[model samples]
Target: MAAHTAIARPPLVPEIPLHLATEITPIWQATEAWLGEQGIEPPFWAFAWPGSQALARWVLDEPGLVAGKRVLDFAAGGGLAAIAAARAGAAMAEAAEIDPLAHAATRLNARLNGVTVVEAPGDVVGSPCRWDTILAGDVCYEAPMTNHILPWLRRLAAEGAAVILADPGRAYLPGAGLREVARYAVPVTRELEDREERVVTLFRVLP
Candidate 1:
């Protein structure tokens, strides 16, 4: 894990550094092997996804969006967005993930950046949200996952929580009820995406 930590830097948000994989394949091989030994899936938390990068960027540039708000980073791999929110002066910032290993990484990454982010445990989607702002990055990459999670996000938005998502042209993102507030050309490895770079759109989920 130390070797993994050695390779990562906040390539997108350099000011707020994070432990991220330098490359896609090699890190996944090593991390997945480690996970296999532990009987779990490969930890995607080890890498900085383009969507998360875009979300973090927007938060830093427009801190007023999160300032004084309670924030929740859904599926907060590596907790980059959550850290950004905390740094942007959100009243509270918290992260939630399904994988225990990912949660461990989130805590470590939070510490690395000198931020206090509470770990929101249990089924994040099933619970009532108390946050004023909720951020989700790169979660629309899969169909089943998108189908299952979007409704919960919509519900949160309807309940007056400010739910937003950053996505890089994924197959499953819905066509309606998303207001694009920002667009970014995010750098990514070819192994993880078809393009070496992607244009990520930061969308505000609306009623």
Candidate 2:
């Protein structure tokens, strides 16, 4: 995993260092070839996506939101937000990922940032909420994924967990029940997002 990525800080959240791919194509091809599979999902864990970058920035700047709370970074790619929560003095910071590679990357990145992020292995979609705050970044990109996770997230919110979602205008984001909390203009590469920047909106998920 370390062989293909370089240690670098994301553009928006420079305080945290992540193992990121310099280019998308090479990492994508390498992962596919290494797995010996076709039609595999792109390595989302190798890049700090706009949503997670925004979430990390918010948590770092406003530490009280997560300080002394049990925080969960849902669908944590590279564990940017989780690491930030830990740095900001959260009592417990946990990262949940279904992908083993992503879990490994999160552990590696957490260690690099001098933090500890508990790993929530496998699918956690239907699990009962065990966190005080939940940070879900860039999770609504695909329709099927959005459909699969939104209900559980909404349930968590309804159950008194603060479910926060950061979205960079992904197509599958729900049209209602989101109360905007913050917004950020996150810089990105055209090769990945087809744009130089993305305006990421952070919202508190309402049930």
Candidate 3:
């Protein structure tokens, strides 16, 4: 068996409560704990994706929105959004990520949150399973990935799934019919940095 070593971490700071409370924390202490336990470094998006925490925080604060809904958290990294959705009374919650490493981290975080997350990436095209709502956080920063995801999201909407996105005014978030439901001024740091770092808006994909 491989030897395990405890990783020391700085004490976590208090996170401010956003609109959605029971659903998520602005700073995901559970994800932090899970990452420490696994001793795995995070992927680029986890660090680079702007407005991720803000989105998760907002989702956590709004349980009524997700209540009784079947939710799919696409490209979930630390499973923050999925966890929040589950706590918000979503009938079903699942997470999907392209990277196997992210899937592992998502599962670890999910377990930390006392929830279950399906750890696999499925076809963006013609999904066999149906979901009432699809949650996407910080997925519109990259041009290529945005190009790939937007069409599929449109298709999902056409198929009767509601798509919600959390974006920090990224270049790609515009041109989509995403109406801003909530907004927050999230504190950012250069320590764990992002390209266009700052506060962001959480928007719901309108039909």
Using TM-score as the measure, the top candidate is 2
Tens-digit per-residue lDDT, 1-207, candidate 2: 788899998999887889999998888888899888888988999999999999999999999999999999999988999999999999999999988889999999998999999999899999998999999999999999999999999999999999999999999999999999999999999999999999999999998
Give each model a TM-score. 0.92, 0.98, 0.72
lDDT of each: 0.85, 0.95, 0.61
Candidate with best lDDT? 2
In candidate 1, what are the lDDT values of residues 1-207, reduced to their tens digit?
A: 557665356557777777776665666677768666643455688878888889899999999999999999888888899999999999999998887767788888888888899998766886787999999998887898998898899999999998889999999999999999889998877877877888999999986
lDDT by residue for model 3 over 1-207, one digit each (tens)?
001111111111123111211212222344456456543434432332445566566656777777898988887765667767876778988888765656655665556567766655754444654888888877887798788887777777777887888786677775857777877766555555343246677777765
Where does model 1 exceed 4 Å of error? 32-40
* lDDT score, candidate 1: 0.85
Off by over 4 Å in 2: none
Estimate the lDDT of model 3.
0.61
lDDT of 1 at 77: 87
